[model samples]
Target: MRFLIDFFPIALFVLAYKMADIYTATAVLMAATIVQTGLIYARDRKLQTLHKVTLLLVLVFGALTLFLQDERFIKWKPTVLYASMAIALAAALWIWKKNFLQILLGSQLNLPAPVWARLTIAWIAYFLFMAGINAYVAAYYSTEDWVNFKLWGYVFPVVFIVGQGLYIARFIKDDDDAVEKKP
Candidate 1:
């Protein structure tokens, strides 16, 4: 359910692109993202930083893409977003001596400070990789190829998430183990 909310906009954008063109797809993405944001707020009553950032970027870049009739703006949005995320995470960790991943998910999982630090660094690296890859594809590839990459690039996140889950699993205490220890 949550994944659907997060993904439907991109899916619709691709569908719109297939049926019409990049301009139409941009409009559909803008509208779909707006709807996704509203649905999230309605469900949670508050928006996360990522949600707000995504919404703002979609609206701003989508407007530019449509208004200027340039597909490059839309193509570059993901690169900008990923770069910004990497920068923010790096600055927060190094300059501020804060771990945002810990702040965000610390309550849900119990892990050592070192583990959280490692996870934060991992996320920063992942963002940088994503940003670089997107920039490369957007710059060197045709619009058709970039669009195809957008659809197929879902593999990267899925793999990253699974890898992260595997890493975090070692730290998560099984409920049954806790219960057995309680005796």
Candidate 2:
């Protein structure tokens, strides 16, 4: 449900682009995203940083895409968004000496502070790489090709993150076992 809600606007944007009639798709994108935001707020009573950022970007970049009739702006949206996240994560580590990623997600999984720091840095790097890759594809690919990549690229990072989580979980399990056996 969460995944579907998150992706609903992007899907509408692509469909609207393909249809390419009266900017109907941008309308759909805006409507869906607004509703998504409302629903999230209703559920949580508070907005997350990511949600606010995504909404702002959608409005700014989506409007540019519609008004300018340039899909490049829309394509670059993901890149900018990812780049911002990467910068934020990096700043949290180097400047603040706090791991926002772990702060956000750590309660679900018990891990050492060092491990969280490492994971946070890895995620920051991943975001930077994703932004670069999005730029590369957006620059070189055809419209349809770029849209397909935007739709499909979502899965690649999820797969990588899950793989990393599984790898870490294995070590965590071993650590737990060792502690349990230590009397």
Candidate 3:
């Protein structure tokens, strides 16, 4: 369900592209994102920092794509999003002595701090790599190829993330003693 919510805008973008054009796809994506943002705000009764940032950039980039009629603007959106997240995680690791990813997901994870920190850094690096891949694909690929990448690349990472989550689950129980003894 959450995955569907996340993919909704991209699906709309593909549909709009097929039905009308890039501009139409951009517009449809913006509408879908706006609705998604609204739902997030309504459910939380306030905007999260990450959600606000993502919404702001998506709106800005979506409008730029519409205004300039340059498909590149829309294409760059994912790269920007991924890069920004990677940078944020890296900053948290270096500056705060806290693992932002663990903090964000800690309620459900019982991993030790050091393990969580390492996982956070790994995720940051992974995001950065994905951003680079997105840039390369968007810059060089044909429109159909880029769209296909968007549609298919998503599934691969999702599967990997889930697999990693399951792997981490095993470590969670193993770390329970360390977690409970923490000061």
Candidate 4:
């Protein structure tokens, strides 16, 4: 349910691209994203930082793509988003001496400081890699190829998320285990 809410916009964009053209797809994506954000706000009564960033980028890039009659703006949107995330994560960890990921998820999963630091670094690297790959694909490929990559490239994030979950599983303490260990 939540997954569908999150991905329906992208799915609509892909379908629109296949059925019509890039401009049409961009319009569909813009509208779908606006709807998605509205739905999230309605349901949660608040928006997360990530959601706000995504909505802002989509609006800005989508407007540029439509106004300039150039597909490049839409193509570069993912790279910009990924780069921004990488920078934010890196800055939070290095300059601020904080792990934003830990701050967000710490309540759910109790891990040591070292583990959190490593996880944050891993995310930074992943975002950098994703940004680079998206830029390369958008620059070197045709619009059709880039569209195909955009739809299929979801695998990278899915794999990364699964791997991250598995890596952190060892550090996660069940309530029963924590209780059992209490003196």
lDDT of 4: 0.94
Candidate 1 lDDT by residue in tens digits, 32-58? 999999999999999999999999999
Q: What C-alpha lDDT does candidate 2 achieve relative to the native structure?
A: 0.82
* Cα error of candidate 4 at position 78, Å: 0.4
22-138 per-residue lDDT for model 2 (tens digits): 256666777788889999999889888999998888788879988988767777888999999999999989999889988888777778888888888888989999999999998
List model 4 lDDT by residue over 1-183, tens digit each.
787888898889989999999999999999999999999999989998999999999999999999999999999999999999999999999999989999998998899999999999999999999999999999999999998898889899889999999999998878998899999
- Please provide, for model 3 over 13-107, each residue's C-alpha lDDT reduced to its tens digit, 9 standing for 90 to 100: 88888788888988898889899888877776887677777788888999999898888988998899889999888888998777887788789
Question: What clash pairs does model 4 have?
Answer: none
Span of ten consecutive residues with least summed lDDT in model 4: 1-10
Best candidate according to lDDT = 1
Q: What is the Å distance of residue 132 in model 3 from its true position?
A: 1.0
TM-score of each prediction:
0.97, 0.85, 0.87, 0.96
Ranking by TM-score: 1, 4, 3, 2
| Cα lDDT, model 3, residue 71 | 86
lDDT of 3: 0.83
Error of 4 at 107 (Å): 1.6
Candidate lDDT (C-alpha), each: 0.95, 0.82, 0.83, 0.94
Compare the candidates by TM-score and give the number of the best one: 1
What pairs collide in candidate 2?
none
Q: Which portions of model 1 miss their true places by more than 4 Å?
A: none
